[model samples]
Target: MDNTTTEDTSDTEEEILVYAEFADSVNIEKYNSMHILGIDTKTPIVQMNETFFTGTYENPLGTYMFFENDTSPQSTDPVFDRIPEKNVKYVCKTRKLLKVEHGYITPKDGSGQSTQNQAQQAQEDAIKMVSFKTVQEALDKFKQEWCTNESSSTDNNINNLKES
Candidate 1:
């Protein structure tokens, strides 16, 4: 009797897991390999929920995944500067054009006090601005008018109170 073990390649499938280090400054060698695979450049290569940033760079050749290093864009980066700027514009900034032209902000200190006053004024204004031919109309108008402001106010408060 002849005993032999036959190898089966047809029914067996090999699984491959590929991992790469992503950073703003990537190794060109690694970048080339990922680019060949057709990954999106802006999609994150790694992330820890705001701690780490990952994405890709798109060039004529292809896309290369990247991780944001210490030198890369950050939460404190200019994009994030928008929050404070917006807050300043909303709460603490007094503007000649905005006040006189658009009437967005009153000609006052534009501090927290002004913000509160403006908010109350806005509520009053909304109530005055919304004319209800029917109760349903009023309700719908109120929902549309205040829903975004209410949610955004809460979010802004929470974001301001956040430690980091």
Candidate 2:
């Protein structure tokens, strides 16, 4: 009588469970090791209610995977400003431009506010500008902004050409 237990190790890469949200949709996916985590390599394609979305740097597929000891891009040492802790949803910060040409910020208390506050406020405003629940909504907003702004100037140019 032979009592031998054989273990099968067929695949090298281990599958991990991940919750990813983007394009106004959420997914519980089994992450494959072949995934390239970065801005360039498009991955984690999603289709929700007939609309499709691909992971990009600007609109990334967020997950809970991040190195706790990873340093900030600005600095290589000192453990960075701080690594995002586990279970805490980290927001991708959209910073205001360091300088805006011919731009002026209204002062509070008759004095300029802190740069950090200014930058944070700018980001909040930008977030509100394009906040949408779905892709169609975003597209509609873009169309309205794009089409309406150019039409007035374009019509004037055409009228001038006809008059000339």
Candidate 3:
């Protein structure tokens, strides 16, 4: 008899207990705070008598309201009654997104080709290719050259090499 009574009381207590928070997301980082909305603290709800707060803990304002995690506030829910909080996690502050504009694919018009392309044809034109051997020779020529300043001096060292 006592076991049956305990089960009935436990069921009623579970139904009434509601836990919530001002959450940025319902992810692993849900502990992070968001805007706070304080419930009607001045006049408690006649039945529940629970003070529910909305918004962040720092800034508790009643401008907005909150509902349970699973219960979403819908157009169908009647007034002076309970509604659900389905999208509690969905709202990001990167929140209340009005619209998302995505970049559209450009038409394959002749004017709209890659800048590197010689023509707007489907394929790119082949470029002139230089051989590695030719490039190395050019580099060697530059490295071997002695870049002397064109100093205006008329000094002649050993006018001509004699057969000493």
Alpha-carbon local distance difference test for all models = 0.42, 0.46, 0.33
lDDT at position 6, candidate 3: 42
In model 1, what lDDT does residue 67 have? Answer: 40
* Model 1 residue 159 distance off true place after TM-score fit, in angstroms: 46
Q: Which stretches of candidate 3 lie over 4 Å from their true place?
A: 1-99, 111-140, 143-164
In order, how many clashes per candidate?
Answer: 5, 0, 12
The numbered model that scores best in lDDT is 2
Candidate 1 all-Cα RMSD: 28.4
lDDT of 3 by residue, 1-164 (tens): 35544444454332222223323333324334433222223212211122222322223232233343545346554766565444453322212111111223456666544554645443544564545468657544433442232222311221122212
Overlapping backbone residue pairs in candidate 3 total 12
- lDDT string, candidate 1, 12-98, tens digits: 655432234333343344332322222323343332322333444433232333343333323567654643322211212211110
Residue-level lDDT tens digits of model 2 in 90-159: 4444321111112123546724456677888888888453479997777567656765778777656645
Model 3 RMSD in Å is 21.1
Question: What C-alpha lDDT, on a 0 to 100 scale, does residue 119 get in candidate 3?
Answer: 54
| Poorest 10 consecutive residues by lDDT, candidate 3 | 94-103
- Structural similarity to truth (TM-score) of each candidate: 0.16, 0.19, 0.16
